[model samples]
Target chain A: MDRSCVSSRRAFLAALAVAPLSFLVQPDKAWAADGQPITKPIPSTGEPLPVVGMGTWISFNVGGDPVARDARTDVLRAFFAAGGGMIDSSPMYGTAEAVVGSCLARLDRPEGLFSATKVWTSSTAEGLEQIATSERLWGLQRLDLLQVHNLLNWQGHLQTLSAMKADGTVRTIGVTTSHGRRHAELAQILETQPIDFVQLTYNIADRDVEARLLPLAAERGIAVIANRPFQGGSLIDRVKRHPLPGWAREIDCTDWSQVLLKFIVSHPAVTCAIPATSRVDHMEQNMAAARGDMPDAALRRRMAADVAAL
Target chain B: MDLLSYSLVDLIPFSRETYFRLFERYNIGVWPAPIIGLAMGLTALFTARRADGWVLRAPFLLTAACWIWVGWVFQIHWYAPLSWPGIYFGMGFVLQGVLMAVVLGWGPILGSPEATDRNHGPGLWILLFALALQPLLGLLSGRPWYGLEVFGSAPDPTALATLGLLLMIRHPLRWLLSIIPLAWCLISGATLWVLSVPTWPVMPLAVVLYLGVIVWPWVSGRSQLE
Candidate 1:
């Protein structure tokens, strides 16, 4: 090989080596107006986690496309840049977990990244393999949180997750379900099983969880991660069609996305709300929810009713 | 996990953009496909009224070509990598195509006297819709007109037009022929539903309409099956 090409290659490797170290030394610049993110604690461990996180379902499933990967890199960068953490992915989301890993690996500072992915298959052996595969994909030696996706074989996976947690391989273990599904069973597992987190669908429009799951999680001291925070986009899309209600400024929400997101995260039981977005602008807007004082109970109800009216 | 109520779009191996990009790429790479699809659609339309034994086979031949094209190009080539289920969908499309060819070309099902056109009413309109309306929908939905998922170059149009042709044929194997396409309508519809695309309800409505057409003859005491 030519000397110039060899030197360039060495420079690239050197930059890669220095990137993580640079990020580690630098203080997190993702501060909000108060110079700190509004955070909620992990109910079980008392570990403080930023309430706004990123979800990679359809958003990060871009496969082997360089342009798409570059775009997602910006999205991840924005997520971290805005004091985001607890990125949740699953093997079921096609290439999402791998894409997230790739993005984080290339990033300057993914230190705040609280890696969470799921074990999605049927058999315990397959679930174990999937969990290991997720760790490898994300390049994490110890996963912060791992869950049974959609509660598929939760009985088996829960035992496996607990075992992994005991071994210190996984820092936290939990179960996830969305779209108002399997709540009864999920509740049963949460009550019967000793898990750290329970992820479910909770948005302004979909408050079915508020009655049972959220209360149950709070009562049980299990952390709650809210998915489908905007009713999978329709809610935000609807809210965006109209001007933001003047009352939105009362809680310091600049846009409708923040208003909707803030409503979910403000719930006493919600540990975090992971809204999936493919664009950097959306990530910026989403993470902005972490800033600003959240709506109080009456304001939250008003926000819900106002959005519902739309 | 709200598994039961979840959007089918998640089951799709690729993103909505990637799925549509298949059309964008196919339209650009294979310019001849749309032209061929037009010609084939015209041929089916012209042959729709024919009762002659050999001439009646044209629509079935067109349907088979459409099924095969959509199977290979849309499903196998573009969609398979996105998810494992995509491979099954591709295989299903291919099998449906082969089945159509076998039935029309050979014995047991749509053979000899069975391959006859009766009411071309719904079929003609449906074929025309497949050829014309589908692309219009695609264009209205923000996909460029040039990148329209034309019949034979696309799965939705191919499946829609196939249902139209099968409706006219009045064969015992008609429903059998309709199975995969009907299923595709539901699957694609659900995919659209989850993606929050405006056209999500269109496929399910089409399926219901086609089912109504298929069952009309029996319900009216025309008794083709009897």
Candidate 2:
């Protein structure tokens, strides 16, 4: 074309050459090694929460109230320190909601404390009432997500929730189903609703969500939240007895918890997996799972097969 | 209420004669409680001058309550009754109410950030309280807890009633309610000289525990801890 156009193209290539060298000296601020939130955007409202989060199920399973609450505080502190925002709790977990609330209040609020709790009541009004109570317990301005605990009072809760969504009292809404009991139903709901996110039991041992749910969520543009990444102590039970495979290091996955977590999160539809842990060390490993070089579908299947064979 | 001690034919499902007799004994007029509650809620909304969009919540609340009772009795267990298809499709419905109220309207329903009482709070709680009568009377009527026993072998009505009472109490009033019936039922059920019955009937602590959970906050203040 013209001489100036030729010179412009050369200058652009020179700039690209310098950009790679600048990257060698400086890394992008968007992410840490965990591949967690460089930044997260709420699918419903375009709000972003950090991809790293904490799960409060069996992890905070301390028998005594004090121990459980303190343990949760440490776990939560670790999550926030590591740039985590979402904290998933449920009425099913007994004192988990209370303890999580206690911890959040005790800490005087962390910057990234995006609270998500479930309502496991039987009736619609009761469910709504619990949601109100949970908000008060946590002392947050608003919750990031409110799921139905194990799908108790599912339809009634949803109808009521639709009005709330229209009113804008809550920011985002999602559903959570643990175990493989209602995958088909969960899929159907995802198919129907304009759901922002879904939380399901998924791990290397239980990658069944990958075959259908994950794919459907991807297609429907719904974000996925994975729970039971340790299969609520199954992965640790299985792999704990076995050694970490040699290939674990290829993806920065060093522990069984990290390995299992990494596999679930490797799915593109997966927004994040809330792995519960009472121990700060376990929380560290869990947060690490959000990091670099996640396995692709092929590798995830291989990981599944390996866990199966084990 | 008199209980039937089982004989050798115990393992089989209840006979038709017994089913008819048991059905009459339980006399489940409570089934319509939720329906009536819905009608009243709708009526209340109609009568009120300022109650605007809040009126629409009645159907959803009534339906969820009905299903909760239905689901509880369907599988016959105290924990979340896992009916085959009901458990499947019900997840969305449950989460929807939770997300909606918490995300959207928890404040107005709870009577705002202040202690000022709201008009609809009592109506909503009373409508929900009507739902508790079914399980309460179910235990009180002393029907042979059959497919109803959903929990175990023999029926223990006292525990169920006590559970109902505890649940009916507001969050702060929890200490005021008595579990004498719950304790007596369990102790009697455990100690009573049944020749050889296996597991006891459904006590339903969790089910009632859940009821207490949802209802308590609504009755007293907007929360449980206080």
Candidate 3:
């Protein structure tokens, strides 16, 4: 190896050695206790949100099955117990919003619960009805955030969401896309629209947003919610076959999920990463990602490289 | 929205466990329906084997009843909540039931010599599989026996059995009757495949088998003589 490469490797290892001690001496101010999750400020309102939120895409769409609904309720219980905040869903996710409402009703609606869903209809009038249905399904008087799901008729829905936000029907309005679709259009919206948040897919394996979208969000003062932190669970499944990298210890990651999540929220613009899970153990592991030491810029690059190499 | 952009995983928004639990709940909620459905399926299988004139219409009527039952009771009431597409699926199934009744049961083709010829071939085997073996495929994945999907009550085996029944008959309108069942075979196959179920191939395999059975006699130059 080159002399400079060897010295850099040694310095990296040295940093890894004292990473946990650094957390104890000068912990990330966002995390108060040893195990409490870390929080990030929403750029639009300066409100603090835990970096790890829950996504209810498939996990909570259990329909009317009592067994499955109760199981999802357990997952949500574990989430709130672990200091989870945002619970993101969509009308497109069929029965998920209702299931969340059922679970919240079961839990009596926990404190610190931040409800986020989307409007996913083409007609502007239907979008308003859909939002009302979402509120009814979620059993909430007002939703904390509403996004134009997959940017379907975003032009019309954004106008409706903006009006809703203005009249205090909704707390925040935004737009979302997944599978890296339509970033160019999303960028145009970010530049022109007055939105509170812009959600897109971002993870260690998928980082196309870093080049432009993340920077644009940072510059435009928009909170960015990173979806598909696990590429809908395929990424973690693929990486789990390999051993956890030795440097994962530096960031207090016991499993590959935390390593992937920390890599996402460590980004300067990412406000939160929503990883969907049906199992309570997985939810607990997901929430744990928000605590302890976060990877720095150099370590973040290395983490991405190591995961990609895996 | 670009419908083609979505993958199978993106379309199916529930786990395999939840899917299996759907059948269990359906089977329990509609208690005597599964029993009646299986009995009707067996009667259809028996009547299909005889292939006697006018008597063959019994199978069509029985299978038609099964389709309507599964469509409304299972698909619309039970499965639609889990997947919004179930509403369309139920509509297709109900249409298939009505088509079978009007075309096969009441049409002039039931008494024709072509429709009466006994088809004790792959068609019988596939029907028997749908009735007796398809539900057992769930056992391979460690699903509970109560959750076993059966014909007349669940969509998968019901669709499969419909294809199998179509294969046994020889009429001009059989293709029209096969449309919804064939489409359902693909849809259910994709759903099971996305859920990572071990028995995912059963539905798609039925499609290939249905197509293969229809094409094989022609490929061997036997259809011309028939």
Candidate 4:
């Protein structure tokens, strides 16, 4: 056997030995050895990113409200405590980037943070300015990833992002589109653009990307970040109205949100799922989704069918 | 750029909780403004009911100041941080204030006997509703009393009260003055509707009622020949 394979097997055995005690101590440690988070390699550079990341959309746009700011700090604390890595935001999300910066400042800027933001301006020159603004607002010397938000002026912004990536101003460059908008164009960009990641709206209910964009990302060695994993809380809301299926235990899902999250990240092509939430409890549930048994292809099909039936 | 691709929820970036907290912090940060605004609204109401001739312009002047205050202070300084479109909303409000000041406050046409006719029907009731009742609606949503959206202070009730005051006046240019207030009513209604607030329909419903009341006098042939 290969040496790396032997090492992996030894790690697996060590995890098996600690599994029962870890489960008794903290359920999140049962799957991964030493309670480390489950991570997926970014295909471009093979950096391990936690499969579940938090998105600061409406959740972090509190806008100078001190009470709400502290409350959001608690949410971030809960997220980092549960082994979260990437935190994605955009200028278009109003004060979300600023609020995230404030909360991270309050938290002393966690080392595990994978600071991801976007350049949303239509002007190519303005894209550089926006990236600077994002870095300043994030209170970071350099951002880990910068995406072209919603593919707005994707061509210009992507060129700028490519240059930024080349000069080491930003580590990773990506493009994003949500609400399943402009997938054909997104696919073309993924085919041609030398990008690191592509974010798109993907949930159990909305699988339009499954037909083409997802596979293309895999083939092109692009990391896929699934936005709206719960379809902006509506999918989980609708699904929660129905009782959890008995078979949900097969993947160790305790709630509809975990099940929904598990379904998204379980896909082989998907690199991560960014779910935005305001509550600490919800953050814990989302992070928990990254730790447990992920659904297989057969279970994924059943999960989708069951959710669709609901 | 693809405007059609967006939904109502996409336009409202903040949650309903944050929005309510906005008013709470605004009300606290600009303390006594809400009280003074309510006082100005009451003064306008009294002037509209009891005074006539040049005194009639008091309500228009007061309403104009309220619009300007809300545009600059509340919308620009407070709400704009939460949503960028608030800057446009503030500019619209400032323009509305200037228009009200120019057309209804100082214009000779507004003080005319025909223009001063008191609309004692639904118009007065609507004005009263905007003054005393609209602020209470926030309580229904379980918001703290400090977060109550008040007239001359908050945009929704300010716009509604402007529409109510416009309904009372009979000037030909009243429709011209009604344009921004009406537009604000619809815009705010859509915003609140997207926020899923229970009182979402109140502003739009006020618009409907204002238009219906304006047309009813003409529809019933109640207008006298000029």
Candidate 5:
């Protein structure tokens, strides 16, 4: 079997979801890239975040000059204009938080920003110190949500965050695990802790989370933020060859990326799916995922069955 | 999920002054290890003779997280006051400078302890010397080298030499140093495309450069270096 073929299939299936917005956003920067309303209310706060969030995780972490800084700022402006609310970053992402803060400083801060980030390191004290660093770098008076990055120092950080949330230093606290490495442990943390959010690897190709993590999060009332939404560009590699299917028009995905994002968001339990894109064009394409009528349950199941076939 | 429009192709240059702005800040020190790491891994994939092999393949992906962590911690060394462990002798001066760069640009040589000596060209030695001397200067000054950092700059000859090697590197050495810029440009280009609105005319230049890296050595009639 050609595994890359499956990648292509997954890519095509993923693209099926975003076909329509290309009609609007593809031609020029004038079309808004973001502006979709929330698909799920925060179970803890019941506040609806625009399903589209800016992921500065790796995209904005470059530096050495103003070009680096200004480009990031423009993307941030587009994100705000397009109705994006969540901005997820981490100290692990290098200069992202600082750059993101600098960009936001230039913009009129968007309303309902669920500013989220993670503390990633092994030591509890170190993690605490890093979280402080993250806040200072991002220029946050208060973080809307904070998570133990990738379960690093999760238990120790949980205690620290729980206390901070209690004292109002942070608005909410959660734990995260990506790369699909720490699922068993992450599952335990979600089962045990009162975390408001849980970040993990989930995409059309990665449905392992669906088996247990998704069901658990919905049951526990914990929100899920899917990272590696494009599987770090692997998903795109898969779809480059396959054109959108003739049947794909029913769902409206012009490009392969929108289709992938829509499929993930179509899930009943997903709170939000955070995908990082450096290109303003990609950002507009991704934000369009929020506006349309997502596939119903039956379609989602069909979408899944077809991709898994390969 | 939010829909973002645009890819690397559509860029609008902010201004000419924007070009000069590159030197105004002390930023080369800041590296996005994830993207850099991804580039490193992908390059390794392109270089590898084999396409499918799990024996060592997954480790390449896993290294992304490790390199990123090291990148994060390295920031503390380069940006913070050099102290115990460092600040203790207070260590963390120019000499510890090696640690600062080590955490960030350690590259393909990472975890392969055997390759360390080979990766060091005539240039790396100068960097090592500067790394050792900077801290001594800091100690003599009674301040952390990073604390009293003038330009947040390093004047290491070795690093300069290595960089010089990069301007025209080929063969095994080219293979090694090329990863640095390859990772740097992609990460920076992606950042620019995603974050800022710039008239970036560099992608085509980048593609050309990438092609040059692959074709130049062969076409130079120096493929014999292989």
Candidate 6:
């Protein structure tokens, strides 16, 4: 049995058993590799949010690992460097809000941060606590936008959010649902409730939002933040193996990511398209969607048909 | 179970990158753990077919060690802080380790490989492949070499080695030993599948292999013949 080998290995293992954790070291800040800014106003407040913003869904839920935290810092650097704002997160995303805070704390430039997060709980009290916790986690004195996540206990939470807005704890109040869930209810709420914004999933493949929700938001003068613009990265993977269409250049889309992103933001009702990404290169690609020649109503139809065909 | 309330909001709160980074960080922090793990896996492979000897104890001992390492190092220390469900997973791995210990330490299970259903050739092959080729899965998936998941330090290979070891053991008790590893394969596999990982199918394949090894000898009357 190589007792000496076992003993030495055991010693090494014990040493490692107590070793300090390796958090992501801060990397050299990279410049945003894209051009220009595209701004759209919140219909209620008339406050402008760049059409290309950041979402912290799966991409930003990196827990407390410093290495992952530092990597996201670089992504944020690329985002803000490209004139991006209106970064969004949720309490349901585990430590994502905290990770976003950690990244923000390390960022050299955070003045343009339009911090947005959700109150994701079942009660008014819990929602209040969660909202306060989210603010603490994000290191913000006041949240820029607060939405009821997925409409879970939405009516109860909306009252709290409405109060928060009136009390100046949050600048904007809204409701959110994704994967096309609860659109009827969302549209009804937008009609009846005093919401400033509506966050929901809207992309090339998932177009149910186009018929009703988009039109309703426009009609009600509610700002729209489009999420899952890449359809949870699945749509990007679907078109990645195929070559970009020659017409993609007409919309200033360099890749399938931008092509998908530009399609969503091109909608006149969409105040912003928050495409979540961890890679700085992908961030640059997403931010570039804001600058290029946007697709017109006619070309947007062609973009949808092309991706649908693939 | 309410179909009306069902939605696609993920129960697991981390992304695929975060999950992979957990393995990467675990493997990196342990440094030479994989080197020692390979030796332990090879030790299990060489000693698995032995009947009524000290050598027969190697596989279970190594399996228990791997399970405990995954329990404490990977699940508890690494994953638990990330999500609340990881605490349950950590406890599950520790429970598996304790169960293996009870079976190996006190019961008439140690060094008692029965001849009834043992297939030395395939058993050795499965054990070696889990220890050797399984670690390369990270590299094949375009991750760096440091992302290699090894038997003594990772969940998938440890569960796989447990199955391979069970293949050389006797009936009823062998069935008992297969429960945890098989259950983990199904669970971990589903999680990976949801995360869109390529190796997701491998767990279900392992479950099929384990079921075949356990049931084939009985159905064919090979156990009666022995």
Across all models, the iRMS values in order are 4.0, 18.5, 1.6, 1.3, 12.9, 3.4
What is the overall TM-score of model 4 with all chains considered together? 0.93
Candidate 5 stretches with Cα past 4 Å from truth are A1-36, A308-310, B1-226
Task: Order the numbered candidates by lDDT, best leading.
Answer: 4, 3, 1, 6, 5, 2
Over the stretch A1-310, how does candidate 3's per-residue lDDT look in tens digits?
Answer: 0011122234334434543232121113344343456766676666667889999988898888888888999999999999899999998787899999999999999988999999887789999999999999999999999999998899999889999899999999999999899999999999999998999999999999999998888878788899999998899999999999898888889999999998998887788999999999999999989877777778888988888787
Ranking by DockQ: 4, 3, 1, 6, 5, 2
lDDT value, residue A215 of candidate 2? 76
Instruction: Return the DockQ of model 2.
Output: 0.02
In order, what DockQ does each candidate have? 0.29, 0.02, 0.57, 0.66, 0.06, 0.23
Q: How high a TM-score does candidate 6 get?
A: 0.79
- Top DockQ: which candidate number? 4
List residue ranges in candidate 1 displaced over 4 A. A1-36, A64-67, A139-142, A238-250, A296-310, B1-19, B26-62, B80-88, B108-111, B116-122, B168-170, B193-226
In the range B61-128, model 2's lDDT, one tens digit per residue, is 33334333433432133111111222422343244324333422334334332212233443333333
Chain B TM-score for all candidates, comma-separated: 0.87, 0.25, 0.94, 0.93, 0.29, 0.87
Off by over 4 Å in 2: A1-41, A61-64, B1-226
Name the lDDT value of residue A211 in candidate 5.
89
Model 3 residue B73 lDDT score? 81
Please report how far candidate 4 places residue B221 from its true position, in Å.
4.4
Count of clashes, each model: 4, 23, 0, 0, 65, 3
True contacts kept of each: 0.28, 0.00, 0.69, 0.75, 0.08, 0.44
* Candidate 5 chain A, run of 10 with poorest lDDT: A22-31
DockQ of 6: 0.23
- TM-score result, candidate 3: 0.92
